[model samples]
Structures are given as C-alpha cells and as structure tokens.
Target: MRREQVLVFDADDTLWENNVVFERVIAQFLGWLDHPALGLPERRAVLDEIQAANAVTHGYGSGMLIRSFADCATRLRGRPVTAAETAEIAALAAVLIDHQVELVPGAADTLARLGVRHRLLLLTKGDAEEQRRKIDASGLAPYFQALEIVPEKDDAAYRRLITAYGLDPAESWMIGNSPKSDILPARRAGMNAVFIPHAHTWVLEHGEVDASDPGVLHLGALTELVDHF
Candidate 1:
C-alpha cells in the first residue's frame, strides 16, 4: 500500500491567482484617487503602509483593504471623503470580493491525482468568511479532507495542525508560495515543505529562504510536484 502522507496546501497564490487580483484592485483604487501630487508608486506606498496598519487591528481581507483605501484617499485629498467617493470605493470592494477564483495551471489535475494516494488538507490564512467564500467558489473544495483558515500562518499554527490531525512530521508535507508563512513554518514544525514561487507574491510575504535546508524542496511549477512525489 502507498504510504499515507498528509499533504497540506496553501490556498492563495499557491493554488490560484490571488495577489494578481489585489494588484488589479490597487490600480483601480489609485485611478479613483487621481491625485496630481501622488504618482502610482507613491500611492501604492501609501496604500501599503495603511494596509499594514489596518492589518494589525482589522486582520486580513477585502474589508481591511477597503478601509485602508478610504483612509489613503482621505489623506491624499486633504479633506473629508465624500459619501459618493465612499460608495465608489465600496463598489470596488464588491468587485474584488466577488472576483472569480481562478485556479493555477495544473492545480486541479495535481490535486485530483494526489487525493487518491494522500490525505489532502488546505491550510490558508485570512478573514474567515472571505476565505470560506473563495474556497466554496474555487470548485476544488471536494479534494481536500479539511480546510483550515487562520488569523496567521506561523510555526505555532503549523504545530497545532500537526497535533490536531495526528500527522507525523516525517510523513507530512506543506506546499505553498510564501516562504515566510508556508515553507519556513512547516520546516520549523518538522514537516517537509515544497516551495512553488509565484511571480506576483505580496511584498509582505517575501522573506529570506535558506535553499540549503534539506527539508525544503523548490519547484518551478505546480505540475512539477506530480513528478517529484
């Protein structure tokens, strides 16, 4: 019989086009600002700063992003934001929240194939409701034996998952795009990790990774995983 390995997958960027949607929405928000003094780069910097601040208090999701956009617009305009402007911002949030969850190439095929031989689990971090909505819409939900949406992805979180599922560190593997959240934490938890880098990774998610780590494996694409395992 094939070994019963516990395979954990990250939902965002790892399995679908997540950060790309956020980037597009940021562009739309900047267009709405239309500040002569603030160029695209400056506006992006301002938004990132505000978003980071809001993330600490409000956590992560479209709701936090919308609030940050409103705050940034108000700061740039040097005046109280009008009700109409707020309405437009709300519309933008709607578009972002309702955007279709597009799967990464080969994600579905790989998950389907792996499901037959391994215990598949989706480990994602974000707003609970938003993450659930995206997972429900992705159409890839059936393949996972469980779905975990957390406030943060850290070593402690991975340890809890390992304990909760009664998973053996030697037989468990975590696969994702973010080194800080997915790869490093899994390795720290004594589980193997597969790093599949994404082009549009969020700046906050970037971190220094030691390629020499024996427990970490790097793949150029999601399809490559099928051949590796």
Candidate 2:
C-alpha cells in the first residue's frame, strides 16, 4: 500500500529570489563604505565574519543583516560610525524587507499541482515576523496546510517538526535548495529529501550532499518536481 505522504517546502531561495536581494544590498552597502583601502573582497570578508557571529545571537533576517552592516562599518572605519552612515545602512534593510516577493520560475505552478495530490507544508528558517511577512506577500500561503517559521533548520528541528505534525518520516518528503538546512537534516530525520539547486544560495547554507544517500534526490529546477509527483 502506498503511504500518505506529506511534502515540506523551504521558503527562501527554493521558491523565490531571496539571496540575490541580500547580495544586491551588500553591494550597495559596500559602495557607501568610507574606507577605500578595503577592497570588495576584504569588505565582504568582514561582513561575513560579523554576520556569522551575529547569527548566534540574532538568528537570521534583514534586521540581523542591518546590524552586521553597522558593525562592519564601525570595525572597518576604526572609529565610531556617523549617524548618516548608520541611516544609509538602515535604508538598505528597509529596501530588503520591503522588496516585492517574486516566485522562482514555475514555483507557483509546481506548488499548485503538488498541493492537489499531497499535504503540503512550508518549513522555513528565519525571523518569524519577517518570514511571515514574506509568506503573506508571496501569495503562496493557500497552497500550504501549515507554515512553520523556525529559527534554525537542523536534524533536531526536523525531528521535532515530524513528531509534532504526526508525520511518518518514511512517507514524508522535504524539498529545498539548501543541503545543510533542508536536505541533510531532513534526510537525517528519516524523511526523503529533494534538493533543487539554486544559483544564488547563501554561503552559510552551502554543504555537500552525498550521492549515495538513498533518501536524497536532486533536481535541476522547480518545474522538474511535477514529473516526480
């Protein structure tokens, strides 16, 4: 007998253009930097270092990114940052948070099709309020049976979600672009995972997926998911 399957989806890069927004914001922030001695690479390195440290306390979101920009600017300048500079960074955060939510090519169509045959859940990691804002704006909420905005996605998180939802791991499928967050953790939690690689995946989310992992499936695009279901 075929088991009833629950399909879980990741919100950010998997369904929409998320990381590119951050990339653009970082570029603009770098352009505003007063320190010309620091090249783009050096500035980015500083930003990444600060963001990583902030992630532990701040988690993830535009707010964390905004704080990172402020911290990076101060560190690079070797002096207190000006109010004008801080405001500029704040404006970048505003742009990021207010940016229109555009779905990845064929994301809506694929979700529509899959939603009809399977119980679909949106499982994403980020600041709850910010994630909710994106979900509300994306117009993809109706397709999901539930929306889970978590602080992090790990094996423990996946296990908790599976248990809370009363989902059979053997009959569940987790789909997303991140190997670290979506693929590895879900697979570790005993669910099947489908990895749809994204061109602009965040650096922190990068991880290797073992080809030999029986629970893992790799696809080239969101549209290809229709063929699987």
Candidate 3:
C-alpha cells in the first residue's frame, strides 16, 4: 500500500460517545413508560410502534426523540399531557444536549499525532446545526484541515471532497466507524477505507462484506491507525 495523504475521519461515534447519549436518554424515558400506571407491555408497545412508524422519516435526532416521547405519553395517559410533565421529560434530553462534550479515549492524542503527517478532515453526517455544536464543544475542530456535515455520504460526497482538496482517492483514506457511511462507499469511490469499530453503531450502518476488499482495513480503535501509518 502506498502512503496516503488525506486521512478523513468520521465525527460522531468515531471520536466520542454519540449515539450512546441518545440511547441513555431513551432508556430513561422507557423507565418512565414502565411506571405501574403505564404497564410494561403497553409502554414497550407504544415505543415499538412509534419507532416502526418513524423509522424512515425522523430516523434519529433530538427532535424525533422528543416528539416520540411526547406522543407516547399522550397515548399512554389517554389524554394530552400537562406542560409541566412534558417539560420534565424533555428536560432529561435537554441535559444531555447541554452536557459537556468529551472525546472517546485516545481520540485527541491520536488525532494530534495523525494530523502531523496526514491532511486530516472531519466528515460527518446529521443535523448540520447539532453537528457543528458538537464540533465546537469537542475542541477537536482545530486539528482538522476542514469539516463537512452532509445529509448523506455517497460517491458524490467523496468526489466533492476530492475535488475540493485536489486530492487523488488512491492516496487518500476514509477512516470512520460506519460500514455503510464510511467504508463501503469510500471503497467504491476508489479510496482506501479504515474501519475503527465503536461501541455503538446504528442498525442501518451494518453492511455485508467479505475479505476480498483490498482497499478496506480495520483497526481496534482510531489510535490503532498510528501503527499503520
């Protein structure tokens, strides 16, 4: 393998505990849903229904989580919930949103090390506003040469980044946690792919694969790539 010039990194779970926060908040709401007055089965039923119905639309976001909980509360109570109760539920999520940002273990040191030799860029997907907020709070922003927040990551996004940077995919590597969003598409674009597993990954991000993908590489964590370099 030739030395790569660009080291594109994914922002969310790759660098920090992202989806876990959402999962934790949702768990709290679920615990509330299991109140004796609500019944365990009924609570699960409501949550399952909401997720099934909203799976394609809202996906995962603060707004979707908030609305799903609000809808579930109304359904369980058989009437609209009071503003105070709604506020309380939303407050749990609010705290998560406002909480101090933290990087995954070794994230900063690894990035700082890699940034010295590679042209580092942060490529992430999701709500642009929220992503920016996380980036700002993370203090990982300065290490990257540039940052991008897109709705979808595909060949077009890859091409745009390459074009913008005047880079050759042959000499650039996409390093991220998601198989769907980072590895597979990047390989298809003729870019080398480095997969660094995270503790949490979304259901849709999983992809079927075999060992023949020469451009694809896997590491235990982001910091592990220092050895590869």
Candidate 4:
C-alpha cells in the first residue's frame, strides 16, 4: 500500500483573502487618525511600526490591531486618547472583526478533492476565537481532518504537529502563501512545502523563498493541486 501523505494548509491568504480585509480596516483607521503633519504613507509607516512592536506584546487579531491604532493615534496626537475618541475608533474597527470571510476561488473544491485522497489539516496563526470564527464562516473547516490555531507557526510548531498526528515528515507538505510562516518553517522541520504567493499578503509575513529548494513546489492557484498531487 502507498504511504498515506498529509497536506497541511495555512488559512489566511492561502485559503481566503485575509490581508485585504485588514488593509481595508487600516485605510479606515488612517483616514480617521488624519495626523496634521503626516500623509497617508507616513501614517501607514507609523502604524506598521506600532503593529510590529505590539504584535509580540499583545498578539494578533482585530482587537490587538485596533489597540495598536489607538496607541498610534495617541502618539500622533501627543496626548492621552480620550474615551470618546476610543469609542469612535472601536466603532470604526468593528468591521474588521465582523467582516465576512472571503474564501479563495476554488479553495473549497480543491480541498474537498484532496481530502478524499490525503489527510488535510489547517494550520493558521491568530487569536483562537478570531481564527475559528473565520474557519467556521468559510465553510471550509469540514474539509480539514483537524483545524489548528496557534499564536505562531515555526519549525517547532510544525514538529509538534508532526508528533501529535504521527505524521512522517517525508510524506507531509505545507501549503500556503506565507514563505515566512509556512514554507520556511516546514522546510526546517524536514517537510516539503507548496508556495502559493498572494499579492496582498501582510508585510509581516513576507520572507525569502528559496526556489532552488527541491522540496518546494510552486503553484499559481488552489485548483492546480489536482494535477500535481
């Protein structure tokens, strides 16, 4: 019998249009902030800096993002953010949390086809509730054998999943848009990776993809999976 292979997928920009929604919210936040001396580019730079710093301390998700926005606004104003202003920011930020999850085209059909032949797992990093909410809303959760939501994805995290699922690294592949979180870490864990780049992937998730790596597979879209595997 052929050895059973496992395919681990990333949820964000891989399965759905995640970062674009965040971009929309960021645009709204920047417009609302409207710093006296800063243009849109300058304001975005400041917010990105704050988000990078706050991500480690406060973690990811819409809530932490809005918190960073508030902090950025406070810094821009050079004064304590008033409660009224905070409330307004929160109101404007609600769409970030409640926005409908947009699944990538053919994602569900691709996953369904793959799931029939190989075990499928979802490996997404974010706030638990926020990630789960998206998974549920996408109607793609049923395609995965197990859905994993973690604070981060790294070599260690991939190894943990390997051990937990009794997966053989040689027969496993990480599929996603993130070279940083998905491809690199899975390669480090002795597993293969499938890279599907997304145009609007978050800046923080950007990293170098070594196309020379023999274990790496590059594909254009989810529908292309059937021909290769």
Clashes of each: 0, 0, 0, 0
Residue-wise C-alpha lDDT for candidate 4, range 1-229, written one tens digit per residue:
3445899999999998888988988998899998778999999999999998998887788988989988999999999899999998999889888889888999989988788788999999989999999999999988888989989898899999999999999999999999889999999999999999999989888999997999999999978987777
**Model 3 ranges with Cα > 4 A deviation:** 1-4, 35-60, 71-85
Worst 10 residues of 1 by lDDT: 220-229
Q: Model 2's lDDT to the true fold?
A: 0.90
lDDT of each: 0.90, 0.90, 0.80, 0.90
Give all TM-scores, in the order shown.
0.94, 0.95, 0.82, 0.96
TM-score of 1: 0.94
Per-residue lDDT of candidate 2, residues 117-171 (tens digit): 8899999998999999999899999999999999999999999999899999988
- Positional deviation of 103 in candidate 2, in angstroms? 0.6
Ten-residue stretch with the least lDDT total in model 2: 1-10
lDDT of 1 by residue, 1-229 (tens): 6676889999999998899998888888898789887788999899899988888888888889899998998888888789998999999878778799999998899999989888999999999999999999889999999999999899999999999999999989999999988998899899999999999998778887798988888999988977766
For all predictions, the C-alpha RMSD in Å is 1.6, 1.5, 3.3, 1.4
Candidate 1 Cα errors over 4 Å, as ranges? none
**Local error of candidate 4 at 40, Å?**
1.5
